[model samples]
Target chain A: MAVRTPTGSPSGRALGLGAAAALLLLVGCCTVGLSMELQGTVSLEGRLFPQASAYQGQEDYDASLVLEPELYWEGEGGLSCSLKPFLRLDTSDPERSHSDLREANLLYGADSWQLLFGLDKVFWGVTEFVHLVDIVNQTDLVESPDQEEKLGQPMLALSLEQEWGTLEAYLLPLFRERTFPGSRGRLRGPLVIDSGAAEYESGAGRTHPDLALRYSHTLGNLDLGLYQFFGTSREPLFLPSAGQEEELIPFYSQISQTGLDLQLVEGQWLWKLEALQRSGQGPGRGAVACGFEYTWVRPWQLDLDLGFIAEYVRDQRRLADDSPYDNDLMLGMRLGLNDAQGSELLLGMVQDLAQPSCFMVLEAGQRLGESLHLSLSGYLFVRTAEQDPLRFYQQDSYLLFKGSYYF
Target chain B: MKRSLMLLLLLALMPVSPLQALAETPEEQGHAIAVEADRRSSGFGDCTADTVMILRNREGQENRRQLRSRVLEQEDDGDKSLTLFDSPGDVRGTILLTFSHKRGDDDQWLFLPALKRVKRISAANKSGAFMGSEFAFEDLGSRELEKYGHRYLGSESLDGRECFVLEQIPLDSKNSGYSRIISWLDTTTYRLIREEYFDQKQRLLKTLFCREYQQYLGFLWKAHRLEMVNHQNGKETDLLFANYRFQVGLTDRDFRKNRLKNLRTGGGR
Candidate 1:
């Protein structure tokens, strides 16, 4: 998936010196004998209310930098190889400057069988508010609006572990498109997602061939999974651009999903669930989310930990439109603080049990002396009922601050 | 006076002997020193080590980590480890995977190398910490003598050997954060040399020690440094251990969580 569609205004100092000369020519071709690592991250982002003007004049403070350099090779029987190249640089949005490869894979293992090949990133469900069976890499919305960044997917997996579970199989042959939010981004979507007119409805669009399968297992305290997929629709559907005036186009249809996930640890609770079902996107639909999380350890003695969460979400294509969680509900809390510079916090809201609109988030992070990190987040939008799908974000309530640095 | 009240009702119907139940009590000598320290650390069926954690704080500032473990030892339940996280380029290729149990609760999994996913950790935070180190994922598992509740408490000399302190207590104190723990051991080889812990309002909070001691295959004793400190966060954590190999033939599919994402190449050896 993910074929670099980083829009417009280039030349940020010649793409930062051609990404430092392609990361010093891939660390001098993976240091000859191979086994290398060179982590990266450097951030400083800000933004606290720039309420519109599309903020295109750019500058609510920004700065980003990333450069991961990993390469590992091994060969002799169970083969192995990895290449991770990812670079990013942004300073006031040049379409959120981008770069990515993130693991050019190749692996093989024998015993219980395994294999993998090229471009990866996989993450599937286990609730944190949303991620309905994670749909293979395609959301990097400018890097955050928290769809939890992803992009990079070209597959050929195969696995099998057996004692009853593991099993996997995939083939997916290219079709990535999904990286929006940069018309000077700010919780976007009021038109403007026209990456040079993307469209497809199959007829073998981007060489469409997708197919997937999964099965996972665990039993003592429950952990299960099931998956299925079949081509073209990593979510895109934004019509209205018959000649451009207000812009927007991105249709991609052909679907067939089916997912299920479940957790259930029990001892400080953790329940979670995710369900999905889609089918050629015209009438079939289904969705679900369920939750629990408990925690509360260390209670207060300076070594804290809290947790709490709740969830419920539904969608049966609520009014046949975009479906912002037809009957949502969420609630949260988290707190951590198990010291040594690894503090944390998180709050949440969601609500819209039929629309009075809620949303609301908050986040926090800390760890600043062992490779730096500091974060703060916010987002709010309350009572916005103009048929709330967040009513175009109601001025995009914001607040952010980041500061990373890790290598 | 009625024949001295019939000899005090036959001395209150007495009958107590067998040398006073073989002269044992104090919780049966603290459950016979925890079943003789779990039968001298049992069979030595699987091992493999290499650890080095440092973590200092309180202005002594320091941080380091590099681990690789793989235990197995389960002859009746409680033991199955797997650590991995060699060097910190942001927790290298993480991986935890525990499985301990002896009567209820104990299973963990973590694998998160920047979320390639395998979470499922909820042993209810076993007193947290663990990677931020002052130990505690309930002090890295396998203390299974049915999860505790003992008591002997007496004997002295620690450091000059001759120990045996005992005291336990934690039969699931709501998933334990220590409402007691004393330990000392080593009255002729039960090993363990020092621990304290307390909290849950009983105060004292931490102080472990373990120091040098190597015995391996001649009946396994191993402990080359273990520190701990943290009396209410003055922070400290040492650990050290090195190499150690024993048995090597692990099983139960090598501590699976789908084998923790390739647990670093051939799952270390």
Candidate 2:
């Protein structure tokens, strides 16, 4: 199996250094009466694959360790700074051993406006199955296949709060490319992705300046958010390397996307919708993810809550899109024990509407004591279609156990 | 005969105040007492408090949780409150913002710190336990006078203080966990002394006792400690409140859903 290394962008490194210098300057000047807090977590994770790997040099089990530390300082006049760094070390895959700064920002908040500068994370959608409009941060694919984890993006953000709504503008100076699993990794595709040979449609490449605007408001039981993004697309197109037919090079394109996400709370039912229209990738197309979650509290005199979720997703780009949820139906159930341990379990399945491919997920978590937490999760791919992108992972069904200690 | 008739007419013409002339009904009297109690606790403008929650199971196993609460009083509607969890490490930085309404279901949004997402939750879970404690979500919300039908159950002596006992039925029976709540209010200060909650089956479910009463702003009476014990399950929860600040200049902006993201963990003043 080939071992691929991640490419480092020169511009991104410079921006990181510049942001760190500014952070230090701000802290040095505001340390007279600052209040500081330090908190973090360390976790050990074990992954067990039920079936033999489809590729060579893949192990049936793997172990990893994660360290995440967060520091916060609040100065006078609504000025505050936060720094969070994350690191993961894997024993099986070299590519999975990586580190990144989740947040390192200086924030100044006034009466009706605020400014944030540095690397930060922003999430923008409400549905449980997928986040169709959450595009500010790049997916940290090596960390989790669920796509819930994200790599921080460097940007300058300004927000204005008014009677009508909150409007925010972002100037994203640098883009973070999506991470991929190594060839020896269980979840990898048949053809390895040569991330080091990444290309971009823009002349400035990863240095291209991105722009985004969002307005959000809540009315009655309804919450709404509308946003527009113009810059490099977070989703990349894979092109076979010129001479290496066994490898694919990611091609980042310039695109414009407009999105709307809404949630309405009615009785025990919560309705959610996320829709987007985008151009500059292929032909202009639209995609939507709509869902509803209904909760039954203390049903049948039980001391727990049962939530039922159903969602439908569709993307006009179909197979052209990298996401497997292009035409799918998802149903899920969530159970919360509401005990002192805060035990919870979630079971879900997504079925491809156009083919005989399906995916299932199970997650359960509970607290061990005051400072330790334990969780178990499993993923299963069932009878994936030959043309489906997930076919490569048909034999990658695995269960993961994690234990975290917080300080 | 004429002189006697003149005396009767004079008696009838004498002025009589409504309070002295008419005997009050129990329902009317209970409603009036509720109105007076609500009015006495209405004008604080805003309040902030820190609380430590202790949950104990039947086997005497205990767990502790810490949280900070902020509330903005609304003149026309129910108060808006935000609760941020600080302890139990795993649940830290989680926030719940609520907009209580006088007549209908309250609107709630929960902010998950790990995801940086604010989720609009169903407000119909009033019957469920709050954070695995004996207190239900309905018990922690603002007590509006219009939400219940009150009936005066007469005066009684509790812990050497004269208290008025009232039996109240929740108006929204479909959502409320309790069918009836019997409360004992101090006659002099109209402060809540104790409450007995009856389940939907009309069985005694729990009892809550408000203790350590403290006065603020010369007129506001606040409870510094509350203990709830479930009768059927033999479980208990104690809420210890500290650092209570009133009229802290909190406004509508502070209670907005968007402000939840800015709330810091480990107790934010």
Best candidate per lDDT, number? 2
Residue clash pairs of candidate 2: none
Best by DockQ: 2
Please list the C-alpha lDDT of all candidates, in the order they appear: 0.74, 0.86
Model 2: residue A304 alpha-carbon error in angstroms: 0.8
TM-score of candidate 1 on Cα atoms, chains taken together: 0.32
Error of 2 at B11 (Å): 26
Lowest-lDDT window of 10 residues in candidate 1 chain A?
Answer: A1-10
Alpha carbon deviation, residue B185, candidate 2 (Å) = 0.6
lDDT of 2 by residue, A1-407 (tens): 33543324454466468557656855774567678888999999999999989977777888999999888888767777888888898999877877777888888878788899887889999999888899999998889888889987888999999989999999998878887777667887877777657799999988899999999998888899999999999888898889787778889999999999999988999999999999988874799999999999999878899999999999875324268877899999999998999999999999999999999999999997788899999999977998778888889999999999989
Report the alpha-carbon TM-score of model 2 versus the true structure. 0.95
Query: After aligning candidate 2 to the native by TM-score, how far in Å is the CA of B207 from where it should be?
Result: 0.2
- Point out where model 2 deviates above 4 Å: A1-12, A15-19, A22-26, A318-321, B1-23
**Looking at candidate 1, what is the lDDT of residue A353?**
78
